[model samples]
Target chain A: MTASRFSPRRLAATFSLGLALASGAAFAANEQYFPLQSYRVGPYAAGGTGFFGGFIDYMQLINARDGGVNGVKLTWSECETEYVVEKGVECYERLKKGLNGAPAAATNPLSVGIAYATLERSTADKIPLITINHGRTDSTDGSVFPYVFPLQLNPYSEVSAIVNYIGQKAGGLDKLKGKKIVTLYHGSPYGKETIPILDILAKKYGFSVTHIEVPHPGTEQQSQWLNIRRIKPEWVILRGWGVMNPVALKTAAKTGFPADRVIGNIWSNSEDDAAPAGDAAKGFISITTHPAGTDFPVLKDIDKQVVKAGKGNLQDPKRFGNVYYNLGVVNGILNVEAVRIAQAKFGKRPLSGEEVRWGFEHLNIDNKRLQELGAVGLVQNLKLSCADHEGGGAVRFQQWDGARWKVISDWVQADRALLRPIIEKSAAAYAKEKGITPRNCAKEG
Target chain B: MDFFLEVLIGGLLAGVMYSMVAIGFVLIFKASGVFNFAQGSMVLFAALTFVSLLERGFAFWSAFAATLASMLVLAWAIERGVLRHLVNRPPITLFMATLGVSFIIEGLAQLLWGAQVHGLELGIKDEPLEFGGVLLSSFDLFAAGTAAALVLALSLLFSRTRIGLSLRAVADDPLAALSVGIRLQRIWGVVWAVAGFVSLVAGLLWGARLGVQFSLSLVVLKALPVLIIGGFSSIGGAIVGGLIVGASEKLAEVYVGPLIGDGLENWFPYVLALLFLLVRPAGLFGERAIERV
Candidate 1:
């Protein structure tokens, strides 16, 4: 046989050797490995880039400022999900493995559909999955979902807060008796989650609720908005995501609906969504659990340390002030706090997935904690015990004034008294479906 | 009466947008046997280039001219690099090659101008104009006029130009056209450039309608049903088919939808196109090609 420069066997051997060496380097590093399921390229990329950019920037900020949480470096590998569930699954499978034969410290699914798909797998793999904003609402019931953490606001709480804000807008809770409200939502589980609560509230408050579904990547909404125009709803709530939010806003504007009366859900209320609509988004109200803008001290630190030092992921550091970006920073802070809290118990040497779970279970972020972290008013006080994964979130209302979002309402708390039974009912249904026994909150640390 | 008129006008305008994209498909399919699946990706790429160039401080017209030049280069490269090698190959092979080209273009667009949704404001005001008590989107109306102008221009080119005759001859029979001194390569290059122009207009209209994002690539899928309703090889068919699909779906959704469920507009067009397919296999304007063994 003639000798060749790149024989198949030799090439295969070289590729294998390269992988071995690369994996060895990763294993040797004294760093905490975090696999980020980021969606930086899709219809949702505007939101994704802002949020994911903030996420990576804050992680970089942590590594640079604090010398890694408790002297251990934070190592992260991002896999793009593109807001598609199948790609999310592929990303999850690809990055589930960690350095030194460790279970992945944590994974952020970032999407509800992806979270739903990975629920069983993550439980089996024993990796603590963190979904700060959007995920399975029942996952907040830690008795059933041991691995998943719906940190900030579950859909139920979010919807109630939105409803409360609407009540506040309508003058009072009792004043909403005859209000005609419509919810233009993205047609997915994320969008569908808000419907049940709306239906329940409609009957209770005597408001005629009509929600319209916009299909995925909703660019076409002429007919839907025309219907909204005909319905003449007093208030139209937008439970949309990705490009759908702006499209809904624009279409609603085209249909002659006033911007202030049309409120967007937390997912729909961000700089990414409103900026696209431009003047059409002026006075558009939306619900948020946290404050927006880069006015926070921690964000300044990130800008000073990470961006100024040229270690930040954002191409434009000015995007650091966006609503989604601030949310991302909050997500990173909660994650790092969980690690720090976990370190106190697990001896601080690159925590296992299980140790991270314990830390998340015992998590508490009161105003005092937020101030200490330099994030004071950016986030509302939160506590996540073994029973409540959501930790009782409250949402504030903000309205876009053609430029920046101005806070319109105070932190209106969700009626946990109402949400608890609903949460337990669904969580019990989930437990029964999966043949899972409820974790004894008293029995575990 | 006003509601009906408004809905009808809206649908027709929406149809005009669909026809813009469908014309790109028909141009490629008529000139060459390949169904240009890359038309959507081309629109996305063109929009990304146009927006990014403008963002980089190029004047509006300068950005437009630069985008046009880049699209011409892309068309030429595609014809030279992909189509030239696949000459005389099965039409399916060429279609698949275009699909590959689309994937390549999508990746290239994302790589070059990072994946972020950009608002391509082409100075088209989106405010609804009240036309005799009926609400009409000025932007959509302008887009419809643009599509009409484009169709008229394409017709004039075909009926009044020697290059168009050569294209028709090449499309009719490559071998016979070659015998008559027509260059197959040149015809394909012009056809691709024409299709590229169609994509740019469609991109500007759509990028203005919805901000430019990866989702623009999927908007091309809507044209498939349009092509099915209209014939794949006829420009007139594209306009008529797009109008039919658009009008019927809107009318149906507004009147007959809520009884079943809301958002019937999503699948109504496909069902209408499929039903039309069953009645006329050759499509509304397609030539009936018969094979005898």
Candidate 2:
């Protein structure tokens, strides 16, 4: 009787309208998704902003310049992690859940600590974790970490590249015999990762390695340098971040350590990091995945299309072709290409998380394509597969010339013959702990 | 031996800084019988103001003068606005009020200067002065000299001046002093103003050394051990306590920190202070008092 009293026609009309809206929202949600777990505040905010700016600018460029990838309309949302692991995890959960109309297709946790934490979860979610150049070295095992893709060189590869450069500079690998290499590292997971690789290399090359761990966000290290002075290490590999890099350089300069002998990791090498040390860091060689400077065509395009068009996220465009920004651009291009690759398989349309994962797993970028994309100066040929997430372990040595970084070495790939077994063993052990079987690459095909 | 000597000197220099801030705490506590937890925040605020003003194109001396003037105003406002209302409140209430004041000052400092560490160069050379294989930084020397002069001056003021006599009278017995025509409120205000001045000096020195940052409040924790070690009521004790804590921590970091891991320098001072507190509850120079029920 109550239902009869209520206008049945009006109720039906209202219900239909609601259903239509909900379905429309659901359809929009299935379209595309991009989740950005960013660190816009904290100790590393300077580096974070540059990279995040590049990422956002590229995404905007995609929307404005290309009218979305294959007309599916690219959608993205950012959650700030503040460079804290717990907050990063929270951002991952929040961003992955998505809004009413958009769901997260891929996650780019722009922090090493965050990447380490999310590596396991990304595997479970099957959501591709595009760790550009910083994350767990073991995640390079694509068979174990099916969804975790460290696009370029990890710490292991970078250190290998640095040591390789050092070897070359010293005339040959035989010259490293009986040499003392000190690793003055920022005492964190990020800094600690380099030690094992260095240690392994030390054992193999018959070199003595002394690891001096500097505390997080290091501001004081006089005693560490003093010890280094007493020991008189032949070379110092600085695996520091934030203020630690410059402080180390300054201390090394004071202690009369040859600036040329101090080699910094990718994270430790930046114009901001180098500028503070000034002449002290003049000859400080740093291993880089991408060359630093704004002379690249890709950066010019970013300046013209993104910045000039009022879509630029960078406050200062001079920081456009810096280390982290270039890394971000490379990451952006990789992400776009993955989507394009996925589209090739599925259809000429917006790809879902699963489709994107497939795209990332099978991405193949040759030298010509890289050059065509204006990413030639930044990165070389990268090909990802189901069994190898890192694609290759290639990096170049760049020396800081007081004001700018100049490339001193050509592209060098890590000896895969040495790394493959290590990666496999680590990945297998990890998979066993998690009760996961390595995904069969042949079966996937 | 040389390394130990260097560390000891560094520690002592650092300790002087702790003492300067602790002295402010001691002065406020001695006068009001309430612990001023806001002393470190005051130091940070003063440093921030000085640096900010300097950064905004104000000449160094002008900025310094403006900072002192601002601190004087802050001290006056705190005495009139907060302390005046809480004069009759319990010691715990006053303590809590100071903590609240600390948070407010922090928020205001952030609002005024933003949450970025500003390099505060006081134009004092920081290069080490070498002497017979012993090296000591110029800033450390300046700090030690300034702290010694300040302490000596404060001791003279308390011993010889009429206002100091009134302050001591107020500290000894507020009710009796008021009956004897000593304005307790005015004396308290002057003491607070002096404490504020001490905070400003400490802030400028400390800020110049470490770069002005929001974590500047942690420096207050460095003073707490000093307060506990030196007897909260004794100005001389504050300086002594600071020296002990600072020297011990620096030495511990060099000799003991590496044994545990890095970053022990930050926590060693607190641990040492805790140990001292366990042994000396009333602190080294605290006056023995008998309560009349």
Candidate 3:
């Protein structure tokens, strides 16, 4: 029946339609989307599943427990990259427009190849590309890479921290003088990124260093290890990935090299890397931005709230607190915190990718904040600025005991004071090559 | 001199591992006249299945038997689904089919077992044993022994058995063999099944060396030069090719590598294979194909 606009029934219908429209707008405006370019079925799937699972689980925990951060719901959708660069770029191009009217907060691919491939695209989209714990060393200079955040650690800082750890182990920095060290690096851009920095460190410390390259998917490394044996280096810095780590340890054993002297880098620090080598990896040490284990209060909460509630993202519960999984949790914490910090500045709403970049730049998680977030030891004190994308360059050393990682040292800070000049120099070269004006950090708010 | 001996011995052992992978390719190529690029994927699938079973509390032999059975089924399926449809097709067609099969098997394996790196402990110690003045890997020695045993058994199977004669006949001329009532399907099925078993052996050895993961499929790259140098159709040739590739690449990396650049071991074998191709088009052991112009 046709009714008058002012009639009681007509008025009720109009009011209901208005409420529905308003609620829809609120739902759209009060959500943040994270485009996950994840690889859960590939050579690197062990890392992919653990990391993305942890990231998704942490986000789920936030949604279930906190009802979203400041009433802004966290949402994400995955595009399977299989850790391939082309697929990652395709995923970024596909998902960068955001989902369901909600703007994308960031894109985390968790791959060096993919991250580098999408660096320009993410910048063009004004979306923050978070490459936590691993990325190009030059990306540390945030002024040149405004939309890129190599959070926690960059490759240069990682190597610097490794050298610092070596120095510490050798009694002092001066004791490294005239000592021999070998760096057995994977054959890739990511693996070769630190060679120059290593040479510089060696010159500064007066240590004799040798660099050996192992080709990609490094399943065989007999020649390289034999070279190491011949060099008789005091320590071997293993910059390995995937199967290379296990093969290195096994070959090192065959060459009569003590496993305790082999220091694995960030990528090689996981249980996936060590367990395959069995007893050969017993005393192997590696540097990590975050330690693995379920002892953290945040992890306990996640286990109780998200996992027990049957909303967890992980397929296997055993990997809940593993290295890659914990890194994913730490990444989730950092991403959410950036959103919260941005919300504080830009009002409580779904902020744009540009706004998230500002939040990332101003991120400063001190000891108190770490404790408050129940991530005191899980995450080190981090402070990012307009000029620095890597908030924390510190790492903790851990040793494999044939089963799990045991934290062996407190947070060891990288030589950022020495690395900044090099980072700026490389960044300036990049800026010139790209014909882009670098951002002035001092002038930025 | 001692360092030279050590490097040479290490290279030889490493070559034996490559020989193990090449043997799979040799078996398939000899029987079906198709270069099974999927042999690498088969290795990955076999190892992943076995390790996955072990993780689920199956004993060694049980897991092994289950994996063997599954591989045989996979062989049967490949013969029925792919090879049967493409009878009398060009060699390139069969090669392309196996390439497609590789991707499917890789995806299916991961889909079924999940993509986690599993450590395989064969209870053989990998420590170095001092042989006179040179240090040698005990694990390498054990692997060499296994390779020797495998070669001996394979040689006997190809030369002595009725299936072996039928397989050789099929390889020479499938049409002729079919005309003689060789039951080409049965021969193909048997060869593929035996190739699957070879894949299982190679998978366990390579998996123990480089964790059971997706990269296990990439070990096929190492087999390529071996296949070229040893001739694709000869199991004995694969062994000889592997030894040459392994020893030469290692020795080159140690000696000639520093003179040029480092990390030549990956490509040095290719250089040797290219030279071999230039000098002998059919390879040292490969039979020269005489096609009527």
Candidate 4:
């Protein structure tokens, strides 16, 4: 039984069989993959858990009910990021390498800061960095960001939509002339992205803009509120998140500022944000990309097919209607749809990371398809091309009615013709700094 | 002038919270000559326990009682298990041990209750109490009142009761108290347990003001200035010191925070405390001791 006594031909055959077995296991591991970098432990866990749960639950529903995306079983693994950028990067590095030597098709970092930090690596890796609703607003220049895809409307477009709503409310765009608008923003990159757009708009509309910053992990904001009181702007757009949202609302109530005059970004518009301030946050307006409430057809389908079957992550199905929860579901749906599109090209089999990028780049969701999926309430017709990353800057306004948010404005598309040049210039400058080239989108067009 | 007055009131109110935490440090130091760094973590632990129980559908009173009972058990266990073993150890060893305890408590809290920030509704209204032209949150007023009452109760207990007398004897000299038939072990246990309850009350008030999170443990740093300004062993000093530090820091942030990048609130008090320490190490109300060799 010694190796020296054994025949060389037999040994070689045994080794080949072992190699074949290992390769078989590797192929088996590559069936379907999506990596989730989550933060279920940290200060932002309140928002994180809701979004992560929704993302996971929707994936689970798709896998269990539809038998995976186009017959390729959808599989995912979550790594805790703790809302820290370094930990998020670490998680990405660990998870991106994938199981059994198969690379992950896509990654949802969830945090805007983490997304921004990992944007470069995603492009280099040729894996789609799907920042569903947040990231560097300039990354919407798909030509420059080739692999980085902000699936939903970017912050700049969202701001434009908000301002458009404000203009409409003030009778017309001319009414904004000589009006003073203040932006009370959280002191971070997420908060800072809105400033340039607001400043540009202020100049164009003959209005004045005031920029006040509230530091991150914001618990104390008395002075910032005091300054806001002194300024007495006609409108205040809040870019604050977490505890900062309620604190701002409570402070505004104390200062006798009309709650209706105060507006929040989509991140700040949530049941968790409003519950803390209670009545003070009532009537507060916020820009929304999707309609709130779980009455949508997609949600009903999910409830019937997923939860009713006792296979959903939601402890309470009612939470599916929350601003963030709904946002998460929408994000999940987009990710799934992208995978389906990839399947159409790469066959009804599990697509690779590069193939998923193709799926994201060529997504086309018409109104008819949206209606069929019961997501008519969630989003408008969205189509992404090689040169255009944002798909389109379409959003609406919603107002809080003490307990819930109700849509108050129709879908308003941002002036993409005006924004394209700006996005390109900024994205090119970023590319220059990073020593990268814009992807050639002429062929795709 | 009105702004100055307003700032002062806010500072004093904030000071009451600092003192509440500082008093816990002062009590432990007085009884055992050790600074308990775990005081802040104890606050977080107690607050999280109370909030988690309440969220799980426990009655407010039941949760409160359960939290207090748990804290008492914790204090007794720590005293018997760790502190009692290290009674004759150096002050640095005790400090390091407390720091270790802080981490252990923090991890245990996260393990027991997931790391989501819980809203600690003290079942108290957060409305501002208007007085003429000035206004203050009712929560702040309650906090100030509760801290004062607790301090008074501790003072009365230390001065009026026989057990208090025995406790004071042990604090003055454990060896002498042992010779005089005072049950040194029991006295130490009672003091630690009482201090644990005080830490719980302090934690709840602070947590109520700023929703309960693991970061609530850092609130103990706010109490350090109090211990520095007031002597380490004096209870009244801890209260007054906390008030001075809290008020001064708030006022500084109002006047000077704009000049800086707005994080002065975190460090200004420590700077003032350090300056005061350099000027008067024994503190205002600290006992002036003379060593004869």
- Report clash pairs, candidate 1: none
Per lDDT, the best of the predicted structures is: 3
2 versus 4: better DockQ goes to = 4
The structural similarity of chain B in model 2 to the true chain B, as TM-score, is 0.94
How good is the docking of model 1, as DockQ? 0.39
Q: What is candidate 1's lDDT per residue for A92-136, written digit by digit as tens?
A: 899888855444788886787788888888888888888887788
Candidate 4 per-residue lDDT, tens place, A81-194, comes to: 878999999888888876555447798988897897787788778778988767878888887888888776888888887778788888988799988898988877788887
What DockQ does each prediction reach against the true complex? 0.39, 0.18, 0.81, 0.26
Taking the tens digit of each residue's C-alpha lDDT, what string does model 2 give over B97-159? Answer: 999998888768766765444566666765557777876767678989999999998999899
- Kindly report the docking quality category of candidate 2: incorrect
Q: Root-mean-square deviation of each candidate, in angstroms?
A: 7.4, 5.3, 2.5, 4.5
Question: Which structure among the candidates has the greatest DockQ?
Answer: 3
Clashing pairs in 4: none
Residue-by-residue lDDT tens digits, candidate 4, B170-249: 88887898999997668878887888899789878877666677667777777888888988889899888988987887
Model 3, DockQ value? 0.81
Q: Model 2 off-target regions past 4 Å? A: A1-31, A253-260, A271-285, A290-292, A309-311, A314-327, A348-350, A396-416, B14-59, B62-129, B138-238, B257-263, B285-293
| Candidate 4 regions with alpha-carbon error over 4 angstroms | A1-27, A290-292, A314-320, A412-420, B33-37, B55-57, B80-97, B114-120, B162-192, B212-234, B260-263, B277-293
